[model samples]
Target: MLAPVTDHPDTAPLVDAVRQLRGAVAASSLPLPVEQVSAERTNRVELLNQLDDYVLPRLTSIDAPLLCVVGGSTGAGKSTLVNSLVGDVVSRSGVLRPTTRASVLIHNPDDTRWFADQRVLPGLARLTGAPTQQDDPGQLRLVASRNIPPGLALLDAPDIDSVVEANRDLARQLLAAADLWLFVTTATRYADAVPWGLLQQATERGTSVAVVLNRVPVDAMEEVRADLAGMLMQQGLGQSPVFAVLESRLSEQGLLPAAEVERMRSWLSSLAADSRARSIVIRRTLDGALDSLTGRASALAGAVTAQEMAAQALAQAAHEPYVRARGEIEEGISDGSLLRGEVLARWQEFVGTGEWFRQLDEGVSRVRDKIASVLRGRGRAAPVEDLGEALHTGVAALIASHGESAAMGAARNWRSLPGGSELLADDRSLAQVSPQFDERVQRLVREWQGDVLEMVRSEAGGRRTTARLLAFGINGIGVMLMLVVFSATGGMLAGAEIGVAGGSAIVAQRVLEAVFGDQAVRSLAAKARELLLRRVDEVLADERARYDQALGRVELDPGAAEQLDRAISQLKAVR
Candidate 1:
């Protein structure tokens, strides 16, 4: 958006990114893991959209300062400390996991430029105060305080990792919006994994940071401070200063050390929230945001790779049953039998001249001629016992030719497709499995036919094919003559003659092709694709359900991991 409109692609979506963060903050809706992933995708997409619409067009105008957002885990005194520093409860603070869902920005009136919410009217308490389509009176409470300064805004973030979950994310967005961090953690909270994780994030991107160790016990202050500071150094925040808010000092002043007490006020007042410092914070914060986005992009790349792998695994599993079924069907098609003794019975009828005994002399003569040709040539049309035997030969040949390697290769390939781990059917499914007929499914069908045709290459084999043709002629007459003689009108030619007519031999071939050719193949492919689709849906749903159960973690910012250095830096700068 910024690229085309302003002849610069870089600045286009900056405002949109801000708005997305702002919306995510306002919505306070948390998602399960899958939903979290979805939300992340949504957030990134929205940010890109914003850069085009709001940021790029205003590229010539967006000169705002950094907002140093102080966020933390729930019960980590995020709000209490904010109030203590600002000398008032600008944000509601409590012991609940989520004391604040909405983010509070504290700064002097000079710092007002950074507060861009359309809700802020002159002397307004909050955005909720602004009359608009979506308004809630109760939501408008945190007064827009003016004590911070130009180019600098102190953000009271919800929590880096809050069980309320939404607050955790509120903390994340606020972090992204900050130029620097006044990261706070008490002696007890300092050791937490969540905050450390966030601190590490700040260090990685070189965000100018300061840490405050609030409510430190008097007895263990030195030890805790040293250990915490050491950990921060290890996290590469060695230059960061740490400030200790002594618990005993708060008690002597008649206030809970963790509360908005006087000393905390004094320490916050000592920091220069003036124009120069504010400018530095603004640049640093924007750079930090860019770094964080880059990090997020890396995480998404990993997710896409995993998704692709899973999809491939599923495809292989679906193909297995399809391949096997086609192979079996081809064997059946070749022999012209489906669990029947018809093939052998028909062949015997033709070979033995079973029905020819009733034929006229001329018909019998034709039969004899054909048979003599076969016997003398040792024709390839040797009589078979049954359809079962013919089918067995082709099937055996196919399996033997492919061997175990082919079977294993198919199974291996299936592992790359989804449900690969579970494609092996149980006894019940195996029993119900049936081979489907199709001309294209398996090349074996052609092989089966070709093998049968092989014998017809020689004169002897051709003689056999001819013998079957002639024998059926004689029997066909015998049966028709009998039917005619039995007819009431003396019309022997009127009734059906033989069960297996000679002329009908060619017609049966046509019927087989119609059943097993393109029509059957198409039908089978559609069914297979449908079955696989159903299975894919089931697997994806299960994965998403598990992610839903884990939605609680979605709000954790990848940053809270560098508290010691931030604290050390703040302590050094203390008055």
Candidate 2:
């Protein structure tokens, strides 16, 4: 065990920084680039577990004894090598398919306190009695031995390529928690894919590694050692020292001869006896782990930003269609499209087209006589109810068509994104027309017609309004306002093909202009048009809000990237 690290002013903040980064990464959610995000999240979680089980605890208690993990593939003689190094059978060694199921950590009795608590490899439950293959495989069996030096502990980990996948994963976790890896392999299996793959990872992490090439025939020792040395150098691990233990017959006690592992034993003894050497090894591995975490944390932060951007894109996709729909509705109101077809026919029927022109030619006073006579029933006109119903149907149909179109457009946009594709694949109803759409349209049209009546009644200003207003009740004036809303022109004859009934619409426009003036007529149209457009926008907004609610379900912290960046900066500064 290493001596506990002396307290420094920067230590507390550095620990907090690491903890904060771990929490941020744990809380991050990604809905896009589904496969890639899943891989990233898994890797980050593994790194975080490594920090908690090894790096942070070790860094805080730097004076604790060093832990050297004995790790290798199946049948690599790892258990035998560990037992030989300690000169006792502390770890199980056999020809079984997987000799070690649970890990065995051997420490000097004097250094028991270091491994006694839930500080190192805290995820693993501590075990005291000898572990059987049937015992829960998740525990770590601690064995105290005076033969092991005071400043070091040797952990015999499971085979990296055990037939059981859980053993392989546990082996990796144990290696990640080690201060150094004492990797053992037979001369015959040194070039096997599994152990070398692990060696490559150790190199990338800058973790200190020492290789022991065991069970080598004496004649082939020099050649195999040189070739293994070359492979290690090519893999960027030339500095990792390799020791050879020649193939030999086991003694009656089932242990290698003392001479066979003498060099490896002496090296570990020197490392443990010399505190400075132990400290150097710990510092090298610790620094490497911290540096690796800094880079990984920043990458995780970038992933968070990507998630945020994708969510925003989905929201914009649902919002943009409504914006276009609102513009179209406003354009239709201003450009006289609403006055086409049925509206024009209804207005023409409301007054006799030929009689209006004849009365107009007789002059303004005769026109007033014509209007009063028509109002008093000299002319048979369309009922106000018919015009009002037609206006309501036209406006409601416009809203319904545009509302359905917006829903489809938003669904198409969502399908174009990876995250959205998954969400919509199972629930396509989100893209369909809303079930309550017709009812909403009915309600909105009723509200708009009511608004138009209120506008006419208010614009009358209660002056000289009793007679003409009584001649045509509130519904009559409200229907007239709806017609004027459909056309910006005062019903003037711009062209024959133009939708409005130029003759009769102008007569209605003239009557209103006379009673309410040209400005008041314009104001009524403007107010009614504004109210209709406002209602349409509200309907669109409600539809768009469904997508917004989906985005809200994903938890993405806006400040996660900056928090990671700041933590990395502070970590580097302290180091």
Candidate 3:
């Protein structure tokens, strides 16, 4: 039995700190598909189970009955031991491999209030009834019996090495929730790997544990007990009490003989009746659990740091390729590369050749009249519209090609990354440019062409150059301006293409210079170039956003690790 709650120091601050730590752990997501990430995730879940099922509840209710969870390997007779301890069949025991399906909590009727609520192991659903063979392992069955003492509760947990994964997980959770573990093992199976693994964990966490060496041959009791005791000493559990039960036939009611469990039963009864002794057991387990938190929480914090690094690396991998794509787009627009094929031929037809050049050197007024007369004679609408279409096609194709390349580059980089292949597998569309990309690029070029025309209209408004603009036609001048903007950076073209493309740019520039002076034409080209690049950037950014969305699915809160560290430090201080 525990003393009054006031016998212990106030733990409100410690509880609050641990709660904060739990929140941080819960918020630190590890969704990336990496090798170390899976193990770290398991550690995170186990830590959370310990805090929720035991630490927080025990801190708040220091006077709750001692919960001695009887847990061990498969076929270890844990259920039979629990029944024999209480001197009744509170839990079923049989030859079936897993006799205990749901965990059975047997408490004295007077202490039912403590076990009936959600204070401890709050995640499990509670069912109150006699223990049954059909119990669901997902729930906790509460059985109140006067045969058990008030200050102690025996919870029969599932086998530690149950073939069902859920049962194995539930067994681990129940053990973590215990104030004391009554670990049971048969003499024949005492050195099994699975039960010893859990014992090692108990040693690390400092949980109070006792061993039950059951079903030893009567003549071999001394040998097995001594060997088991020596093994416990080697594993740092020397102080844990060990009880030996010899192999014997069961009574008609399937209960062990009264003499077989007398010593262990008396020990539990005395431990429960003595408040000081009970407090020692509780405090020892509680302090050990608390002491283990700093290292465990720190480990979890480190895992969060790893997750953040992985996420950043993935985002960067997706970002670099788009950055290069933007640079390439800028180069294509400014290096006179876009003024090839259809655009160049269309420009020549729209501006004519020898006579148009001679006319440009004439007076501005004479040049304007000749340009208007020749355009009207040639029926200039078709030539102007044809040139506009050619420019649109060229710019659209330039942006579309680079956009596709950027998508492929980002996808390829992601496949080479740790978790990237899985993400790409989930969304195959990310491997290529978006379905609407070409459509957007076409609209972008058309909108930019419209913008250049508007600039022509705006710059020529209320100026003497308005006549030259009208003579050349606003559409024709806009197309000429597009040509100049394509090659605005000067000298990227080389060899024969440079001469043709370079001469075409010069003709477009002189025509614009004739209308809007040299400085104004240069200003218009600069502004137009800036607008086109800005639009291209917007298009490519949308493409980059696809990768951003994928990364967002696995993103962790960047501050989760620091918050966990602070919580652990505060908990240590309060303790």
Candidate 4:
């Protein structure tokens, strides 16, 4: 049994047939989720458009006749069954055994050309020799006759699970072409598992089916028949008809009895007895197919959703490191570490020898004192050293913690995702980050260094003495401006030198800043923004990588599906 699915992606537009209904299905648009709402509305339209490609083609290509395929294990009397039903030996009926090699599809002679070259279904064929009804008895030569009636073509397939692999492959191919299947088996070999597995193929694709019991002993007939029927019922194939064939001795003319042939003919008539039976078979086949397909559909959907969750989790996890790193960087910029170079540069320019001599001991002793304090404070804290190794440890920890835990984690997780995994959809795919992506992320974090250093450098641009010369800060600039205010008043104090400093002496001091009382506002604002940028960036990057990797992994390997689920769990916890 199989499912009859009429609507699916890549078919006709779902709402296209609305002209008959005097309206349409609004097939052009579907509402997208808020998260997916982009500047363009294309994906929404694509959801509907998929029907044109995935579904419509399968529907329109249904012009081929309904194939009634007869298949079974070797010596199930399938050939004899096919022969008896057709009222002719269209296929060889044999005792010398295992005769059929190529699958023979018997159809109307005119229809042979419709499918002769088909690789998938092979061909409806015609016999070359017309010698006799008994000619080439065991060769199982083809016999394409037009007597099968319209809308029906009969296929005789090779045995599944055959000793020859090619024959088994042929069986599989024939199964694909069968719109209806007649599974013939004997009472002795009824409970075999291979045929049931093969039947799953048809059941999953809406193929109509009938079961035939070709040989049954008189005493065990009822029990065997019931047992087989019970199995079918368990598999939800109860509606499929069961037909019986009794083996008989050949007549003197080596021909089957007329009554046995008539019984086989009667079965064919029942197949086409009325439209109701045809519809029943069709519906049952379609339903069975749907049942088999449901499991696969569920699995695929779970994989997709799980991938999404994993990406989100990895992103948020990455944020923690960046947040910590950003704080460290901002604090350094604010207090002094980032500005050390500029401070030294300006100190050489303005203070030169005068302030250098004064502050040299103070600064170096401050550094020495810090080291001594640490060495002395070991009972309370820990000893400190001025060596490069000592300096490197704290600095390195600040850099490594955020980059590795947040950024690298995100990259790895995303790289594991489908779109971001290996064999990416594009080079840009972020699914779990690879070694290459890790290198790229390091570059992004390093760029932040320039910003941090620049902020410190800008504040330290002029020497402290030069700043004192202008007297432009909160503590001293007012006094310098006041001196100019008094001296520049001129002539009122005759003999007083009123000469101001060079070109910059006339520059207006921060009278407004004094009034507003927020002298460090600009520097503070820049520092805050930079800090936030680092933190947010770290979080976003980690998640994006994890998401992409998980997605990519899903696409690349089925084994990654479980990993995808784990990633999804990580994603849900991210926020």
Candidate 5:
């Protein structure tokens, strides 16, 4: 026989470890919308209830009174059976569908200290008398009866198949908390799927159990008893004693005949009086509960892992599109594509197109003097501000188009992922770029244009008085620098547009070289290009942050699964 838990060397450590394990299990959450998530959540709650209601309390108070929870289908005569066992009317019995709304624990008056406190079934509030009108189903009514044996307590649980879902749930919870189950069923309900399902659970958990076949017809007693015995044997519950109570009328106090309950009552009395027998029952149930923890904990860990994987997949889906958008934007700036449309037209006007282009091949001095005479004779101002506005419009459109595309791509990818639709529904703004995107893009382009002008002025430091700089002016040179940056990779351009754009770039580069020298012009272009790309990167990152914020609401803890595994290992080692 197993030794009493109170005398075991590892009892204290074992309890501590189980307590830690309970904390770990409670912390594991399945917030993501993965498959089978509901079932796993229910399993998690049941495991926690078992640990809190039974395992920890039992381990700590190994010598506490044996708690036998009487449970079965609706109208199973559970309350009547408890009253008969105690030989008093401590528990109310009736014809109502669920006579026991709240659980009633009847203990020997001498053993009141055990049931009066929150040592076991701590989830429930304790009431000191018979259930009254004001009692809620969540409270546990404690009845101190002198007729009950000293070392035993009988808890009349709600019907397992009660029409009320809360009652059924409470019944299952109470059964999981039992050291022994005294399942009462009438001849009609003996074959019920509900009670038998619970009986199977009891067998699996190694809980000590006994069956009382209540209200058996006198003529069918022998046959019904034998059939039930065979069924119990087939279910691996053969060792559990079965008692048959012949159909009999109730007494004035609505109690079963004394002769009919004497046998089962004697059996309970004997088990309670014998310390060794009580210890065996407690050890059997407690060990089974501890052993079952590994598999349940492992299953919970698997669910946590699933949540983490799903979250990662969703994040990756959102991330890839933004990466593509950034790359495409970088390519757009380098390939001379932005030099078309209004920007090209503005550039032509600023440089005095047609005859002015034909004279560009002349030596730098002759070309500079010709430009000054042509501009001074025309008596018309250069369109420098107009060119700047055109550049602003082209660059902003490029960035905004790619930003919109990235948003659409991410939303489409998320639609195909598990649980992604729900998140999208919760925050519909993720499907589109942020409302401030256009405003931010416009601001970014304007700032970039300002920086380009500043770079031009700084590069012209000592050369501002040169004839070439005086001819086109600072604004004229700044816009030319902007055009050169757009066509820096002109070799990559294609078709007829390439010649137009490439020729435009060469003219701007020659003019800039006249003022700042060849090396200074190239350095200025590189610096301006670097600055523009960096600003674009920041704008795109802010747009991506919208999706990230949505994801943050549902992401599970990355370390939760590992914590649960470690807790399980610690508990197993102590066991």
Candidate 6:
């Protein structure tokens, strides 16, 4: 980084900010609906490599040695050129197509420490001499050379257009990590699309680049050089100097004549000897890399946002149906629908239905005494138990049907979402309610009946009231509360076809009013309705938890967008 010079801006903070941006993007996931998968992957890899390889390393030591990566299309004589330029066989040159498997970096012994550690190009493992270990493409063979100048290093990378995908990727990564790209291309492959594509990238990145036209025949050198120069100018690279290495007889080392590479070698020597030139190259590439981060990081941030939103949409889809089902279950209870069949029949048989209203009008105290006396018979509890069991079964079935419907609705909605469909395909059981759901509903109903009985016992206020409660028994009054709970919309007295069940609710209301005053009856009904609804809510929550677990597995990246924005803001401040 820039040491705090007298008036110059500090660069350490800027480097740290970019590193933060790189870390955020590195941890983010690129889920579906990304603009382009391959392009996004390439951009992410480039940003990370730029941070690890060039910007951080170079900024840490601004005066470190220069690295020039020699890259070209397959069979372009890059290794041979590297050996010729250094005047030694430090790098192996051969006739095999796509010859360079692992990269080799040659540096002067005086500058070995600068390249020995991972300060520069940290992704690559540094080694000495010919490789004795397994051929790992991620490693670089560092050969300390006396022929090369003190302030420079030459890295012979793989072919840019290799048949192997890994080799091509490594070449691009190496080039991005270089302070200078000394591109070598044969006269015939100069206009190839792949090499030109990379050159265009170099132009865009503002990296220092030079070209070597190797194996050009002497007769057409003028024509080919002119055309290559014109192409370079057309591609916004006219400022890049071009050198020609003419076809000539090889020496005993199978290398070109010494005179053929003299011009390029002399230019490299001059570049190494001039500290200002090396500094300019490093600064140009570093600034370009820094400038590109904002746009790249912003795009990655957008991808993170898309992934988060998609996950949210999927989760909402899984929940909306269950929410609707809970509402419908409550509605059914409030509308007197569950009291219709067996519950109504049994209550009427137990209460002597058709004359129940006539009996209620004979004065509250007298009606309470008469009902209590009738309910005290030893035979009364069996009919009460039957009615309670009928209500329990009805409520349990109601809950089970709604739970199944909610499960189906949630499954149907989830099937239309992006990642949801895949999850459902692998786990089709989610579309149906659990087999134990009905048993849970039964248990809940039984618990609710017990709650109603406790409520009745608590509402009885005095000795006479206690005597009446024991005579009628808690079972009779508890069933009365449940029947009132189901008739929340209005009892059968409001002119419904289910008036038989409605009469039972009305008789229960009158009896409770006789035992606990008019206000107490209304309060008891309100309390019973509240307890029943609360119990049903608990059941619905249990059912909805299944879908909740599914959505929980999505694992959306939290705070990734904010991290990116903060890093970008810091970078902008430094700029």
Stronger candidate by lDDT (1 vs 3): 3
Candidate 3 displacement at residue 376 in angstroms: 4.4
TM-score of 1: 0.52
* Better candidate number, 4 or 5, judged by lDDT: 5
Quick one: best TM-score, which candidate? 3
Ranking, lDDT, top scorer first: 3, 5, 6, 2, 4, 1
| Candidate 2 C-alpha lDDT tens digits along 332-438 | 66556666667666655555465665566566556655655675784333567777877788888777888888888889998887688776665667797678878
lDDT of 6 at 366: 69
lDDT of 4 by residue, 425-497 (tens): 3444332333554444445444433343344344434434342222223212222122122122232222312
Q: Judged by lDDT relative to the true structure, which candidate is superior, 1 or 5?
A: 5
Question: What's the TM-score of each model vs. the native?
Answer: 0.52, 0.83, 0.93, 0.49, 0.91, 0.84
Worst 10 residues of 1 by lDDT: 478-487
Stretches > 4 Å off in candidate 3: 1-8, 132-134, 353-376, 465-467, 488-492
Tell me which residue pairs clash in candidate 6. 1-59, 492-502
In candidate 3, what are the lDDT values of residues 150-215, reduced to their tens digit? 899999999999988889999999999999999999989999999998999999988999999999
Candidate 1 lDDT over residue span 1-575, tens digit each: 01122232454344444444333322332122332457555555433432332222223233554445686656767676776666555676655556675566666666454455422221223552322334321232334566543444577776677776545654554454455677888888888999887788667655667788877777998999899889988998888767777764433322344543455444444444354554444444444444344344444434433333444343444344444534543343332232123432544443455443333234544544554454345542333223224434544343333323333444555445443333423111221111221222133333433333232232222333443434323223222221111122212222333333322222222222232344432343344333323432333333223322222233432221122123222322320
| Cα TM-score of candidate 2 | 0.83
* Model 1: number of backbone collisions: 55
lDDT against the true structure, each candidate: 0.44, 0.78, 0.86, 0.46, 0.86, 0.79
Model 3 score (lDDT):
0.86
Better by lDDT, candidate 6 or 2: 6
Provide the lDDT at 417 for model 5: 88
- Candidate 6 Cα outliers beyond 4 Å, as residue runs: 1-9, 19-38, 91-99, 159-168, 186-196, 213-231, 244-257, 352-378, 422-439, 461-468, 490-498, 535-557
| lDDT of each residue in 350-448, candidate 6, tens digit only | 665466556666676666676666666536788789899988888888778888898898889877876677667766778888777888788888888
